[model samples]
Target: MGLWDKIKDGLTTDKGEVAEDAQSQADNAAAKAKEAQDKADAAKKDAGQPDAPAAPAPPAPEAPEAPQARPADEHKPKRKPHREYTVVSGDTLSEIGARFGVDWHDIARINDIPNPDLIYPGQVFKIPNK
Candidate 1:
């Protein structure tokens, strides 16, 4: 029946019988969990949603994958050398940094922009070497 009742029965019954019953219950639980997971995966695929733990599609080979141990952005790769980005209206240095995978302060140092907030449209920013 229930887990508690099963446990009680297990405690009072022969060791072999209790072990057999417990094994059966565990197998049934495993089967149920597998069925539920399969259904969820099917629903996600039907709705055009990718599996959370799986890559949506294989990405470019040169780009490195996120390491399992570290997730901090600081560990992300730096921007390639000599790349130039033009400042657009409403663009902030922080936004630019995120796009190029570099630190905002690094961009400021390379461009010598006294205030990262003070960039004007059509101004060019350089992405320095890693």
Candidate 2:
């Protein structure tokens, strides 16, 4: 038999093995994507909390309520710092740094990107200092 025919025959026999491997890889990728999507959905839900409402408009001056004092050293939960920015058109490392009042080197280090020039539009970058 010719080389082409022999190769085709081998491939035909191995097709199942190749298909199984491809399917396994696809399943793994799909699972990972689902996990990432779930995390994103959870974050969105957490960010949309309605428990905290904006402060009411300043009321006219009135008699203050009796102060209910607490311990001077009482510990309260620290608020998580916000640190994310999306890349937009006409955006550069220097420009973003200037806008956020941070150094370009710090931004690059926080993102772990070797090349700042490689960032593209729609890519979200972490604005560190958390």
Candidate 3:
């Protein structure tokens, strides 16, 4: 009976050791699988080919454009003569127009006045070139 009990105790101890060894092996396998996945990711990055395409390089800066030459006539417009007149006391549209050698109707039209007889003292009027 003593030998039988010793044999049963040895068998129980061996079973426990076997379970521990199996658990250790499983942990090592999991660690190795993680290391392999990390190495594969690093290799993909080093190859410069990711899951998505790389962004395109920005376009090269454009060169400044040269100034264009224009014709001489483009700088000159048709010239018109302008005259300045100052209003005096008791001045009317007829008197101002006669003094400037222009018709009262022409004066009123050029100055954009609603009433030809509404000229007042101290107002300046522009007489247009005929």
Candidate 4:
């Protein structure tokens, strides 16, 4: 069985093991983020030293852009909103998409899945709006 299959098994057979795995992942992610932040802060601080030329202040976060104009369809009904799905044993993107009448690629794009082969059980992915 593959790593995904092992993860699926972990979800049902060993909840504590799955929780530990999740905690490890979360810790790794947090460490990476902190390291990146430290590097950025160091670079910024070094730039403003008396010997170096003054660095420009970082730009503020941009506000969300206004939605582009679309042709109004007052008569047509809106499609159903998207939903979230937790992956389970024997689940695949194609299978889930087929269940929801959505394309597997679309589901991957919605969840930003770089490698479709790497989905783990218990991972909650947001389905796109139809």
Among these predictions, the greatest TM-score belongs to: 2
Give, for candidate 3, the lowest lDDT window spanning 10 residues: 48-57
> Could you report the Cα RMSD, in angstroms, for every candidate shown?
18.2, 27.8, 22.7, 26.5
Clashes of each: 0, 0, 0, 0
lDDT of each: 0.86, 0.80, 0.81, 0.85
Candidate ordering by lDDT (highest first): 1, 4, 3, 2
Off by over 4 Å in 4: 1-81
Candidate 4 structure quality by residue, lDDT tens digits, 1-130: 9999988877775678779999999999999977876777778778883333335578999999999887789558877567899999889899999998899999999789999988999999888767
Candidate 4: give the clashing pairs. Answer: none
Off by over 4 Å in 1: 1-80
Question: Could you tell me the lDDT of residue 29 within candidate 3?
Answer: 100
TM-score of each: 0.37, 0.39, 0.37, 0.38
lDDT of 3 by residue, 20-116 (tens): 9999999999999778777776788899856333344789999999898998888898765768788888899888888878888887877898987
Candidate 3: deviation at residue 90, Å?
0.9
Best by lDDT: 1
Tens-digit lDDT track of model 1 for 1-130? 9999989976796889879999999999999987888888899999999865532577767967777785687678865666999999999999999988989999999899998778999999997655
lDDT of 4: 0.85
Among all windows of ten consecutive residues in candidate 4, which has the lowest summed lDDT? 48-57
Alpha carbon lDDT at 109, candidate 4? 91
